[model samples]
Target: MEGQFTGADVFFVLLGAILVFAMHSGFAFLEVGTVRHKNQVNALVKILVDFAISTVVYFFFGFAIAYGTSFFVSASELSGAGSSGIFEAKGLTLVKFFFLTTFAAAIPAIISGGIAERMKFAPQCFATVALVGVLYPFFEGLMWGGNFGLQGWFESALGAPFHDFAGSIVVHGVGGWIALAAVMLLGARIGRYTKDGRPIGIPPSSVPWLALGSWLLCVGWFGFNVMTAQSLESISGLVAMNSLMAMVGGILSSLVIGRNDPGFIHNGALAGLVAVCAGSDIMHPIGSLFVGGVAGAIFIYAFNLAQNKLKIDDVLGVWPLHGLCGLWGGIAAGIFGSTALGGMGGVTFASQLVGSLMGVAYAFAGGYLVYGVLKATTGIRLSSDDERMGADLAIHKISANPDTDIMR
Candidate 1:
């Protein structure tokens, strides 16, 4: 019976890994649909390659940094034939690595959208290595892995530990803030701004593709959130319910607030999902709805602020959707996850604030440092000629579709 349960746990997490892995396709399609036709190939290639690099770096370095576990031991130890160590659960640890790795890879995937069209391929790959191998894992260790006793301190000082049912702050917030730094450092795409400080809009190439990406992500997010349980016994229907409620709230709110803008409508659902990731386990369904609605509204406002007033060309508005909304999700966990709100208690607003802010600070600093250094030495942006030609031709030497004349 014990052996059967262990096998079940392994299968559960393995499925989660597969589902999250599928989300990368969603990421690729999202970017493909968002960027212009000239750069569509680059969008597809970047997500896949970045994910590849992330897997290698995270396996060798980031996983160790976050969990203090390594796969350098013998096969016997790894398979749990030897006495239990970090490689416990009869090879389940390795599968767990696969699951967490998808989350780690998402940081680069999120950043890819913000810096798209203008970033040089090699530099972005370097940035990916640095991020997955070091920067992301540092904070990941502090929060999820309990490396430096940050959670312990939060519990002692704030009446409850910071509770992130999934990874609202850890994944989305970190990705969003990091992407913001990259976007700011890379500067706007050519013609995205005028000499007189006015902003110009870059319309998406295909709204249908964008919507497809959203649907794929929305579907896979169930695994992203629910499978944080890591075991069948630990899984909660509440988490699933909250995720659904949050997604709808985001959809409906964005429909109203964004005035039927397809872009905003699609992304608003993502905002709700990002916001609910932190508190899904604790918040009631109604609370989740409110959280999603607020997140949807936040995305509309903040995206406008970042792009228009701030003049920051965060191409996909990732900072608003993931960074700010994820931060809200973290804090919302404290408010909506309270006993008074019909949630399972054991959260404090102060702790949530502290933890969420810490994530933001770390993400911003790390992103700036990594991207800034790369910008100085390796040259992160493409040349003016390359910018004019688009990333498909400049980096990949191909367009999404060949001209009919060329084919003939």
Candidate 2:
């Protein structure tokens, strides 16, 4: 029985890792469909390469920083066969690393969407190394790994510690806020607005492709949220049901609020999923519905405000969708996870608010620091000529559809 459980845990975590890994394609396609056709190939290439870099960096440095464990030991110790006892008996620790590394890689994947079209490739890669290796893991350790006694302090002051069942704040919120800093540093894409400061409409290259990306994300998110349990015995049907309810809630709200705009409708689903990540394990399905509905509406309105009113030019609205909504998710977990709200309880509003805000502030500051340094040193944006030429051709030396260009 012990051996059976050990193997099951490994298989479960491994499967979760694969599902989350596949979501990188979702990120790539989402950016591809949102950016112009000329820059589509760059979008795809950036996501794949970012994942590769994130995996390597997180393996070498980020994991150790977050968990205070290193893989520098011999194979026997790593596989739990040695006297260290730091790892599980059946290689479960290694698979756990694979699972969490997928989560870490998501930081760069989220930023890729915001900084698309004009970012220099090498500088962005450098930024990824800094973020995944240092900044993200530091915060991750504080919240999840109990580093610096912050979680204990929160519990002492607020009567409860922060609870992010998944990574609404840790992954999405941090990613979104950091992307905000990068977007500000990069400025609006060329010609995104006129000299008079009025916004210009740059329509997506392919709506179908955009829809496909959303579909892929929605499907994979189940694995993302549910598998965070990391073991078979801890799985919950409640999380799965809440995720489904929230997804539809987002879809329905976006459909109405966005007035049938396909882009809004699809992204609405993501907004709900993002918000529900922190509370899915505890919230009732109905409560999850309201949380998701609100998140869907928030994305539509905030996205419009960011682009039209504020001139932020976050290409994919990642700030609103991930940053703001993820913040809301962290707080909502406190509200919707209460026993008074038909939830399982064990969360507090004050702690959630403080923790969520802390994540946002940290991410924004770290983003500016890292990107600011890179801006001063290596430079993060392409030159004017390169920007005009499109990243696909300028950076990769080929257009997305080469044969079609030749025929033209």
lDDT of 2 by residue, 1-408 (tens): 999999999999999999999898899889999999988999999999999999999999999999998999999998889998898888899999999999999999999999999999999999999999999999999999999999999999997999998899999999999999999999999999999999999999999988889998999999999999999999999999999999999999999999999999999999999999999999999999999999999999999999999999999899999999999999999999999999999999999999999999999999999999999999999998999899999999999899999999
lDDT of 2: 0.95
Model 1 clashing residue pairs (backbone)? none
- In angstroms, the error of model 1 at 262 is 1.0
Across 221-273, the per-residue lDDT of candidate 1 in tens digits comes to 99999999999999999999999999999999999999999999999999999
Cα lDDT for residue 188, candidate 2:
93
The candidate maximizing lDDT is 2
lDDT value, candidate 1, whole model: 0.93
Question: Can you give the TM-score per candidate against the true fold?
Answer: 0.98, 0.99
